[model samples]
Target chain A: MTLETNRQLEDLVAKAKSGNKAAYSEIVRMMMRPVIALTHRMVRDREAAIDLAQDTFVTAWEKLSSFRGDSKFETWLFTIATNKSINYLNSAARRTTERLDDVTVSRVSNSNPEDDMLQGELRSGVMEFMKGLPGQQRAVFNLRFYHQMTFEEISNALGKALGTVKTHYREAVKKLREHALAKGWTP
Target chain B: MNCRECQDELLLYGGVEALPEELSNHLDSCEACRRYLDEISEIAARFRADSDLVSESVDVERFVEGVEARIGRSRVDRLPAVTWVRHVAYAASILLVAGIMSVGLRYVDRDSPVNGVPPSTDQDYYAEEELDEGVVDIVISDFSSRGFLEAGDELLNDVTEDELKYLEENFDVRNLLL
Candidate 1:
């Protein structure tokens, strides 16, 4: 978020607005990781997350002319990505086909292999715990805890009232902790 | 404040935000609340850690390529449909112009003869002669008055001026002369 980086991004956005595909591709390259990460966390499916990320960029490109520069480009992009992910999750086809048990959590612990397995178990357990919550609550939790976004920003992105977003985060935390305890996690 | 109230505030903010002085004081004196705070902190830490791990594991190149491929395919898919519409429009325009030209040509052909024959030719003069000999005589007299009789005087030399006046009176030859 340096001034120089902001300038560079603005330049890219300007170029993209003028129909420069290369500039847009660079913007995509710069944003693809976080976009995919946010989308992956939301959808919990890699392929679907990739598809959503691609779709988010495609939509952003198609609507580039309508961008009024009222907000940061990243914020605008996140709004589109969040809505797209939420809509996909809410779709009947996705609802019927998406399975919580399909996720295979990988362990990244470097202490010991036994500890790694336990950490992997805990990670997977947390993911499964999160899957039981509603999509909006889970999104709020992801944005708040994982992405470290303020509730106010999440409210703007999700188009929900700030109080409602805070309540969702609180409820999500309560459910997640309860699920973790129910799964024999201490604390 | 009571433990329940402190814990409720902690649940909302906890490790995510700095606790107020009152909540911080409560946690220092209460083991249960301290443990509760620790548990929330641990959960948040674990989630953050897992998120970091997941982010680190993502294949940036693969994701970029996937996005590029999807965009390319979408553009490619739309191009043919757009080109087809354009082609259809062009063909319709060409047909429209050709139809207009054909109609105009038919109108022109109907207005004029097709064999290069002038409408006011010698055959038309002969047809008029068959219609009325006296009318022909007046036509010849009118032509002679216009100085066109030098080549055809032998044919109308017998017709007199009085005969021309009678033809003009009976046949309204003045309309033709005009």
Candidate 2:
């Protein structure tokens, strides 16, 4: 997951490794959304996303000494985040994913599917469409869409092959379009 | 290509930019598949835009504080639940061994008759030396999981395997340990 800003986080990482809580806090502030966004898409819930994202940050802090700076900080950081999210998803203990309350658009609550496809409902409709995607596909699509990560970057972040990542993205696109047409969205 | 095959092919290039002759001819013959590919592109564009609109805004300060609070604990204290269980089990095992040793050494009646007969001459007994004479290395496989057990402070090696099994069966060890 790439941050939009190109600000260097390595200096902060060094300070953090040397036991600067303030520096670590700054890193968390910078990375909170991208990490949360990935977790949210992976787990499909708000509270769990925050919990897993916090776990990622805390784990990073504990393991900060071992970070060799071999890869970009964001790449390393996202690898941890993505792995945690995937683990939580695979773990039987993961809480059932409630539709994220933070998502702002509740799932097209107009009672009539056709009537709900008005101009104002597209955002929520899209949210509904996205919610229906499989967890891995959702993770792949969101990393590409929100973070502007290339397929290779997402593949590295997700620990998937580049071809597999593209396949996930392509499948996700196909599913979303089919879902939209089924919901009466015209060409 | 048939519609399924044609759609699969179109889904790859995502709406015919470099138009392969075979797929282009198929698309020209098939208006519905063309419409399907067009809708796929449109959906992708709209999805990108609309997903951006859904607010994923996080409370940064609160989130940072949460991370800070978690990391503030010692690494051992912050171990996950399964690891914590292993730690507790290890610590409890040491305590159990010590308790069993004390029970075996002090409470066992070496002179008592067993079912109206005298005890075997070769039966194992407690050592003459006390519990503090030597260190008992309780070799827990995962060292990180061992939290308690201050080494030589609790060594009770005099208890034999028979004594441990007998004591384990006679006593409610799990309840006693916990």
Candidate 3:
């Protein structure tokens, strides 16, 4: 977010927009962390997340020429990644949702029975909790809570209305709070 | 409002800010619902403090390689269409140029011969050409071989112009350049 870093990023984007693969490669290295992190959170599978992220970049490259500089490149990328994840979730909902829920619930069930968890354990625990939510809720919660994005931004990213994004977030919080209670968590 | 409606109001309105009066009254009397609302608030606050977590298992090099491969494959996927277009354009250009040159070469050399034979019309010009030249060739060759043409310049120099004119009028001489 620093001016220098942002300037460098814009330069990279310009080069990439002109079809510079090396510049795009640099961009991939720079952005891989957050991109993959968001994707992994969305899909709850590392391999699928990587595949989705790869798809995101390839798509971005293919369409780089059409990219007008209206939004931050990362925001644009996050939007694409978010939508791709949502589509993946929607298509695979019947096949994979239950399986993923089982994995997350079982893992969370093995967490410390005590109401309180250490910060590291809590973070991982929350990650698993996030993984357990339904697709829209997971996406809304991740963008809203972790990214601190406004409801408006989440709406744009998810291609949903403002009301829908808020609903999804609230639903996610309710699910988390109830799950925490079931696990004897204090907060 | 009952607990279910109370919780739903809290979720929809984001706590009691826009909760209906009935829901507010329910929350005041219900300790469990109050705790539920408080827990959701606390979780939100806690999430704000933690930074985003990235999985350490992601291999950047491998991921980059995969993207590069996909890009290359997609380019390859798209290449055939462009190549086909180029192929059609090139074939059209070759045909166009060849047609133009064919017209041009014909225009520049209307009577140009191929393999020493002139192009002709409906008649068998080959047979006509052979008849025209065959007699002249035989006369020249025969006269030279008989020593008549070989000795004719000296003999012809002695003849008068009057005699040559007589020969020209008396013999059918139209085929001769004289």
Candidate 4:
């Protein structure tokens, strides 16, 4: 982040702490992209991701006064976002009557079983691979990889220890790698 | 060390902290394991890159509106700010109304026979006014109501020293304050 932007963020944080609605709104606007993107990857459902992201922001806003600038605002926001998504996933798992046995993990293959699939098909294929991951692993992978959050940031956000965060991240990577290799991915 | 141990420690290779020196030295010497670690790192990177493929941008406007509304409601609920403010405002209004009512009562009393009705002595003031529970309802509404809250708020906030002194001397205004 640029120095100017950082200063602006500090100003926003100050305003938000003082209950300035517009400052809070601007902060939310800036964070919307990463929040949505991370939620989408974690939940694997766009509509659900949006809902979870909204929930995350609402939770953040209500809890904004408690924020102490100990962590970056985005990191704090992501922590809340990831937790909300995880909780939603947990609740949905309980309410869902769908059979896990019937749920097939999707595969992404470039070699044509069919002649010419579009880029969208290829993207969907990758998504299917992601959707197959266990929930927490998916979350760790999404935040670390896609959101580019450091393990320390993840740990602080998730209220986890450094070892635990690293474990989740490593396990997530190892699983994805093993899964990819098993399906004959070269690089 | 065997491949299993190597892989386990390798998992920590990327972010392992406070490692035993012996294991760290072994990792340095083992070319095969080093190659494996490099491959793992590359695989992790690829997977990280692929995560972006699964995500799409979202509608900021719609999302912000929903988020703002929910946040506003939650703030109100959590802080009790809305309720408290309403209580304060209603109390103030009620006090204002009472002040107005007292003024009207005084004006009417100026032409009446009984100068000493003693402020109706809490004798179902509604029934005496022939009000069908409506006036009573207005005065007795929850602390959140505009009429009661504003009136009470004003009484609490704007009460004169003399009025408070009077209540202190003659009434349990302390208990009423709570």
Off by over 4 Å in 2: A1-4, A93-103, A107-120, A184-187, B1-42, B51-57, B74-178
Give the lDDT of residue A77 in candidate 4. 85
Task: List ranges where model 1 is wrong by over 4 Å.
Answer: A1-11, A68-70, A101-103, A106-112, B19-34, B52-58, B69-178
Alpha-carbon RMSD of each model: 11.9, 16.6, 14.5, 16.5
Number of the top-ranking candidate, with lDDT as the measure: 1
Model 2: per-residue Cα lDDT over A1-187, one tens digit each: 2354435577788898888888988999888777886676666666777888899888888888888876677767777887787788767665464354444555444576775565347766666776777767877776665555567777877779988987888787677667877877756
DockQ for each candidate? 0.22, 0.22, 0.20, 0.21
**Residue A18, model 3: Cα distance from true site in angstroms:** 0.8
Candidate with better DockQ, 1 vs 3: 1
Interface RMSD, all candidates in order, equals 3.3, 4.5, 5.0, 4.6
Q: Candidate 1, TM-score vs. the true structure?
A: 0.62
Specify the CAPRI tier of model 3.
incorrect
Descending-TM-score candidate ranking:
1, 4, 3, 2
Q: What DockQ does predicted model 1 obtain? A: 0.22
In model 2 chain B, where is the ten-residue run with the lowest total lDDT? B128-137
lDDT of candidate 1 at residue B63, scale 0 to 100: 62
TM-score computed on alpha carbons, candidate 3: 0.56
TM-score for the first chain in candidate 3 comes to: 0.78
